[model samples]
Target: MCQKNCRGDCDCESQPMGGGQRGTKCDVRILLVGEPGVGKTSLILSLVGEEFPEDVPPRAEEITIPADVTPEKVPTHIVDFSNQEQSAEELSEEILKSNVICIVYSVVDDDTIDRITDYWLPLIRRVLGEEHSTPVVLVGNKVDLVEYSSLELILPIMNQNQEVETCVECSAKTLKNISELFYYAQKAVLHPTGPLYVPHERELTDKCKQALTRVFRICDFNNDGALNDFELDRFQQKCFNTPLEPQALQDLKALVSRQLPEGVREKEGDPKQGGLTLAGFLFLHKLFIQRGRHETTWTILRKFGYDDSLYLSREYLFPKIRVPAGTTTELTEKGHNFLKMLFEKHDLDKDEALCPNELEQLFSVCPVVPWGPELIYTVATNERRFLTKSGYLAMWTLTAALDVTKVMEYFAYLGFMSVTNAESQLDAVTVTRDKQLDLQLKQTMRNVFHCRIIGPQGAGKTSFLQGFLGRTAQETDEIPRAHLPRYTISSVPVYSQEKFLVLHEIDIFSMHDVLTPPELHCDVVCLLYDASNSKSFEYIARIYKKYFEKSRVPVLVVASKCDRSPVKQDYSVQPEEFCNLHKLPPPQMFTTTPATAGEPAKVSRDIYIRLATMAAYPNLKRLVHVLQSRPSWIGEYTNQMMELPPEVTAWMKVGLGAAAVTVMGLLLMRTLKNANTAN
Candidate 1:
């Protein structure tokens, strides 16, 4: 029944083929096995070279085909055992060494395909052991002999067994789908979706154990050997980008409890002692990996109280309020009392008001109400001075009566949520203790433009920083002599707003282990060279080519000590020529001198200004926001309220009623406006 197009000899003699660069090579071993006369040798030859031999003789040797998918060529070794008279022990050893197993069966022989499930699969399972994770592909050779529909019948049965990764039908003689069969074989080995073995209660692999240990260490931030509720929430946010909801958190705790040993579970009965131990963490992750269920991990995270939205309901924040089933006035009174209690908790000094810092701390702990400082100032402040209990009550009531969108608009007006606002607020705060200003500046200026200064030793790089800081070149105390990099911070005005300019100065000669990828997350790079030393300029070029040639960040070239350069024999190239040669913009030429010497000789502030202007402000601003607004203990108490029973609490009913009224009022207003326009 062979097709008319079927041509080419089956050359059974083992022929070696090679291509690609010579070096350390990655080897992918493929073992092609089947019943006798399954054309396993023909498939390998067709894939190795699209040439189909007129007659492929039975071969016992291995065929090595070089695959040049990347810079490093991957050599694929295919061994055919169809015609080899090897013993079962020798065949098992061969199968054990393969990365991928290809089970081939001829289309013409229906019994050969049936024998695959009954004989070959069980043999592979016995040889590989149940634990080894090797990829297997079922390939049906000589597709031209029958219609594809006949082959389709067996495909589903093979897929349902889940023993093989995929099934592909091809004609070895016609060279049809031969290449695709090998490509899939390589893919199966390179990118497997899940682990091979499903472990029982007591079984786990070393690699799985190592992965669990790493995750446990990352989650256990304080080295406490266990993850508390807060730590678990933090881990969820880091991994899943959202904290678990209230019920999900409890479910995860229960799941961990079941996985723990009898002694561990007994001790976990106490609420305070209820957290995951190293064993429990490892066991839970192993279960998830074995089941191949990512949703289970996400479910556990959500239950830990990770939420995408920032806002929460008022009732969720304050559960103690008892709304009288009487009138709106009584409801307002109960809400006022709740606010009074909340304000007193935050007003640590009992001064009848909260400061900006205290207010920030209060919001950090409470469910986010979206009540910005401006609205709080208008409602909570008495005589525009302090946020009193009455102010807090009014603000809460007003927010409850409005829609979430309107509440957000009011919150946005406060402006303290931004890096610039936070910086300005910190600057305005009175420093009560010595060195507090330095700490405040460091904490507030989180969004900074990192400028790395690189130059040869004694190239006046340190002197340039000192000059930029309004110090003189002769300020010996300010100049650092350490071989390590020196860091300095300066507040520079950018776009009419202040931004921190952090400079890191590295000694070019001693930068072997210092130039890490993380250290290079800079906004600007400054290459400094002494005008009198030509070698300094050459070193700068080398550094530039090594690190900054493909960098997206701006690079500034500064030629220092222009005043000290020899007019006759200076080896430094002209700024124009250097710029043209390096394909860089024009360089800034400057000279630094002692403060007492002259005002005109100092380094210019314009250079720092230019660096700041070139910074990616939008990205830096977003980074600052993320760093500042990471999940905190603020609003964590809302989780406690969510655990309460579904019965409508008086406070919750009141809040819901208020929200419904607000929505109805907005709808009524829109309807009236529409009617008036129609009239």
Candidate 2:
């Protein structure tokens, strides 16, 4: 639906790759900034060799840690800044490139600790700005020389500045907390606590609360607005990959109940409807951060597609799905089932249709409703104008057929990846074989077809497209032009199979019959003309001769406004005679006369079925006409004969060879006689 992450501060309509924002850097840039002789290079050397180096260089030569060796599974680049080896300009550049900064100090030297607050901290603030998001960790090295913990002295400094994440005292000689110092640096960049928690307020940040609220709502499978036992179990298993113990789950709920008695919803008259409220959910995350378990909250957020900034990552939302030329996309069976479950969860009235309120609730998790008002007219709906279950799936089918990428994005937004346990939305789509191959094989496995509605002005082109949705002429006319839908689609039944038929009106005539690549390409074309206008047939006749005269795509000549008084066309031949000379089927008739009160809604679906049939078997146009012309008994008998065993069908074809040969012989004789008459 969008090129950028929908919730982030980006132009959702159009954005380049990564969208001008940094997310999940390629490698971890841990820049150590401190005064001279603070053992910054010793820390880097100890991390690489697992022991303190006897003779360390003036500065550690930019060491690189492989992604496999790190805890976060991302390559780490430890950049050491030494005033002796690098200038201030180089240091500033390194600071700009760093993802996270570490301010190292010596535990034995109180002067170095004083320099941390006076010199190093001020330098980073001046370079990266006072309100920058780059996290800073306070490192106290040479703890072996001190008998007391330096963390107590550093605690006050960590609280005074919001940029300081935490303080850790380590010994390079004893290798104490050496690896953890760098691990915390990586964790700070991947899952920063500044955006998620407020230490002073002892609560979750506003942005964190909003992100968790969305996650909780998506996991509310029953739409009860609370996470019950079953929902909690599913959430735990999906986020942490382990089942939640029954007692453990109960104990957790009891803790919430004890803290905030009203958080338990049984007082609202139903125990099942009440479990962990949204406020209680936020409270639990705040508790996690308060208890020094912020990683737990970060884990859940990452599993739900949030990055360090708490925006849904682009990689998680728009996974690549390759669709080759001439191949169309359709929804797989699993995709339909997932949407079915979602619909049922929100259909509170149980009428098998989604009312306006129900639909709004269904899209609560999405940033915006992906569809518009045209959706109601684009698919089948109930008499009350609500979207039926069939209409819901049909709308999705149309979207997947036309804009497959859009459908995939909305799938991620709707929690399809998490709820269905699928890696990406590509699993929900099936790309059909090329249309050319389908024609060469004399069959197709596709269930969707696109038909272009090409015609002149005043030919009722818009009315014709909307008529396929069962809308009448008067109802469509009442709607303003701006609100009128440009396209309409619905499913049509062809014998035993169902195919989705899409009708898109083309305004090529508005440009004086100028055609583009889009206007001339489609699975089928509907050449519509007004039967009451003498000049209407001539316009379509010229179009057919100019464009589709020799193309393989199927064409259907439609005579609209049949209910009006008929008029002769200003053309060489009438519609039927023109079609017959070209070996095409006779022009089909169409009308959109208003219905009487209390009458059932009805429109001509057979026309759409014919279009889909032609698209399905593009090379069998003449055979399709023959089948349509045959009586019901003959068509039924043909179907039964085709259903026999392959061996039996082969023998049946052999038995009919003599009659076929006789028909061909008579056709040859008639052609020869006609040629003789012409001479």
Candidate 3:
């Protein structure tokens, strides 16, 4: 029966109307279109019943089943046109009557897949007209026979060729991914969000652009340039099959209002409250696509009261604070109790202080803010070695309120009196601390250097570290397992010149771990790889690209376990070649074995000393100061300037006395000679 005005010549509108209308029982008409022998019948039978037909007759059939399996409990109409012969006109009429279309191809035969673009897609497009907006799903059957990777190559082509919302691969025989495929198709029809438009790669095609334009024109009744709230609701229902919620409509309004120009709101017909212009409509679509519709930008928008949920709950907005039983006698006491709770939660080991790891966990749980190890060490810990409970409380209170002086006084009353000391006394303490730090800095500069060694599992990283520490492979008890990170400080000087603290760990793979503060500040980074295993080298390369490429610190690459293979294998990449491929410097190569005992140790020591020296005196200014301030240089300069030889002094005195006597004699002689000459 036709629900609207329909001509009897075409049966495109023959299906019952309002079957899937919102807030009622959903009845979807799904059309199955594909090349011959693509298992369309088997897929349909699998979806509707348990048995696969041993023999499928060449016929056209319709199976109407109540599908209580879905979350919505909607009935689905499955039309199988597997072997039916029809003219182009008949096919076009059938296509128009469908709610969703699934185009299937056999994965085993690449030719069948090619015909999807060459034949099936073009016919559908020609019949439905260029501006039609029905959703399409591309299905790859017989996935069990072909490698999944083989099917991946042609998926993008299908997506580009048609209004393909999603592509899925399933085996009707094994029933793999069949249910998921149908669910996606149902979603595409009911909640028809338009095709995603990624900025560079996935863009809206001409067809999509035209469809959207037509949609906008249809919604803009009276041919107005904009759409009001009523118009928008109508548009949402007609285009997406689902009406916008009241909150959703308001959010759309708010978004449009914020985007308008300042004076435009005060114009004669202020568009802010009047309607959304065509330009505004396009802009919102682009924004929703570019920033993902949900995770990041949408989440932020909801927090600002743009969505149904007014804002993030208090737990998500603020850190958890628990009040102690008797600590709420006063308001200040209550606040202090809250602070104590926060510190206790973060101090997982219950040590009353936060280690580097514990502090990182705390920062992650707190409301979104700028965080890093340097900030925690400087502001929260007041440049101290660790953050205590009192320090955490003080930092939070100062930031929470506008009156910092009053907060400091309150803290002083709570036994943090040093915080309220006189400015002069504070200055003295600061100067003394600075001087002490300077001395310690000089000592560290002369004594120790830090290196962080990182690599993949079984890359011989731990073995290399053990060798450097003068431990044999047989002494397994002494070596820590590679799965866990280890920290070791060498008391003895490496290369008999520089001491080193080595932090050995695997590469960080998760986002949570990456946000945390590192336990130590390293002067140099050492990347290790096993020469026998090519995969280890590849892992190191990926690590460098992901993490180390942006770093300004010096990175030293080490090729370990060279002794495992006497001759270079074809699979193994030479250290120089690997470095060249990555545009990095050539690495230091070493072999740690019983036969080559003490050789790797010496080489490791040399590498450490060279890296540390470069890190410590990276520029000429600091190097010059260190040299000029050396005790030996000062003593040598003082002795050279203040001391004189006795023989040279005696010679100087004799020469001066003789010069005076000679002058007197010469004057007397000159006078006698002058008088005689004058006479």
Candidate 4:
């Protein structure tokens, strides 16, 4: 196919000077995401040899040129952006257009793991729609700090989920991981057969513009090209200005006041320069803008023509000019005026601009606790909240402020926070009592214990619980007096500082629910089986396999109603044999008898003590005590037939139903309105 022979050196390095082809077709796009100050830009610089700034700024720019691999011969390009100033939608749009994704986490900080799972990963999935479209790599950046246990702990959690392609622990600063990270990202992009199609600027049409406009409306102030303190101040003020009672407002304000303030440590001379600079204005501006939100903000800034050195050279008007760390090369008087105008235009009445502390207060109302107060403060003072689980939780928790503590604590417990100490074996009177505790006995009621009761309708599962509570089942014989396990447990409300725990159901938890990232190893699991019903044993076995497959905990297999069948030789499988097969402790089999069964109730007392002794963690006990001490409002509404006039009752029902419907309708309308505005 060669028409003309290639000339000297001929640029014929193309195809060995034989064929007339330029090169093999290979293209790749990679996105950088990580926590702040993790050397993302430095690592990128080392790999690509492109000088990037420390400070981040709004707007997107290409930061790297195509590089060819020596051995693999894969052509690669990186598209780096920040989550600081853009919404998840906007960020997703950018990522969706890319071929490969790199999620960076600093091994020094355990918090980054949550950010990757709860925030960044979810957003990526939403954009990519399929996990395979863009291969993801969970990067443990800053390998120099890998000695920390938190880093060790973090890697396990990421590995447990098994979501990412591969995890690499490398140091961007030491250039330890620089080459490896590039290799991994390039590998992910090449895994798929087709090339990643990145659209040109024309793709962001009028629709995207409208979407961006609304995002700007929430972020921008005074119709300026950039964000400033005034816009941030207003946002914080609006959050605290709830339509609640005065006492509530005061309480809310007190909580808000505990947050970090804006510009507090921002203007302390730049790290490289000894003198203060007005570049602090640009720093603050970036901090107060959206693109300034994530760890990659600095990387994005380098692409946008700003760096830390320039920020240090500019002079400041205020003794403490607060600005984001990396944004402006130098802050001029003009930058100061642009920022000042935003304050004048939007926050004329407010004296204080949004600070880190105020932003924390503002975020407290979200339903899910944001990743941390630092991120929220950064968002409010600096105008961006990095998308992370913490950020999502913070926003959710703040907005929902209703019983958030309980949800957070439960999640923490599940994460495996030590809830209680193990109980010591003590001598007790009941013959059934032994030094060894049963599965249900070891985990105090304070811990999360799941028990399944199986038997015919006549079985004693409900009877056993009622008798343990010292309540007679006969007074209300038609309806069992046994207390059903509640979805959540709550302590009585008090304005006391003494720390306490609350238990709640997991079903109602919102996306923003602030979960405590602690271990929640289950303490006890009990499978109650009736000796009279052989079928009950099958059910118990199934429930055990389903629930306790992942949980490493003590299990008790209780053979209830031994009095009915008189402990047959093969009455259900042998407890010891069952335990041995499952690699668990031997079962605790006992006969349970109620007055109706014509058997002595003395055995019930012995079993109760055995169970209580095994499950005795202090925290779990306190939770039980707290639940037992609840106010009357939480009492079950048992009255079915009312003594009031039928007409009055009917009217009451109608009124309540109407009110509920109206509220629901209003909420729907408000949601629709907000959606339209955002669109």
Best by lDDT, which number? 2
Please give, for residues 1-679, the per-residue lDDT of candidate 1 as tens digits. Answer: 2111111332212211111112111466889899888888888777766778777778646887766652224567788885467777778888888878999888778898788878988888898786556778888898888775445756655544554766788888888888788876765554332232222333544534443454454355444467766667766665555786757766777877766652123334655345677787766765764454433433332222211111222212222322222111111333334345546656777788877766765554223546543443234244334666654554444343322233333222222112121212122112122122322232223234567888888877776666555544664343344422255455567757865565667778843424677456566788888777756676776677778776655677887877685332233666557666755545666665544644443456777766665553322321222222323442453455577666644576567568757865775566445434533
TM-score (C-alpha) between model 3 and the true structure: 0.30
lDDT of 1 at 139: 89
Expressed as tens digits, the lDDT of each residue in 1-679 for candidate 3 is: 3322222333424322222232111466778888888888888887666656677666437877675766446566777774466565666776888777888888888888888789877877887787666778888887877666445766667546546656789988888888887876776565443433433355543433433443344345534457776677766654354687978876776786687532112225644346677666665655665443412222222222121122222222222233232111111444455347546755777777877776665444223323333333222232234776654653443233222333333332221211122221111111111212322343232333446677766766655555454444554334334322243333334334633343345553422234132422345667887777755666666566666676534566788776677334243466578666654546766554454555542224454454555444322212222222334644564465446576765675577558757865775566445434533
What local distance difference test score does each model get? Answer: 0.55, 0.82, 0.52, 0.40
Clash count, predicted structure 2: 0
Error of 4 at 295 (Å): 32
lDDT tens digits by residue: candidate 4, 1-679: 3322211233322222101111212445677876665555566665665334355344235554444543336446566556565566766666766766788777777688778877877777776674344667777776676665344555554444333655677765566757777776765443321111112221222322232233233334443333333433333333232244545433433333333232122223532111111222223323322221222222222121111221211111011122222111121223223324433434323443434343343332222433443332211121132233222322223222223333333222111111111010011000222212332343221211222233234445554443443333442143323323211111112222211121111211221323231212223445566676755565556555655544533455667666666343343556567666775535555653456566534434444433332233322322222333333432332133265678876886677568757865775566445434533
Order of models, best lDDT first: 2, 1, 3, 4
TM-scores of the candidates are 0.29, 0.83, 0.30, 0.24
The C-alpha local distance difference test score for the whole of candidate 2 amounts to 0.82
Off by over 4 Å in 4: 1-25, 50-61, 67-71, 146-151, 154-163, 192-679
Assess the local accuracy of residue 127 in candidate 1 as a C-alpha lDDT between 0 and 100. Answer: 87
TM-score of candidate 1 against the unseen true structure: 0.29
Top candidate, metric TM-score: 2
- Residue pairs with backbone overlap in model 3: none
The predicted structure with the larger TM-score, 2 or 3, is 2
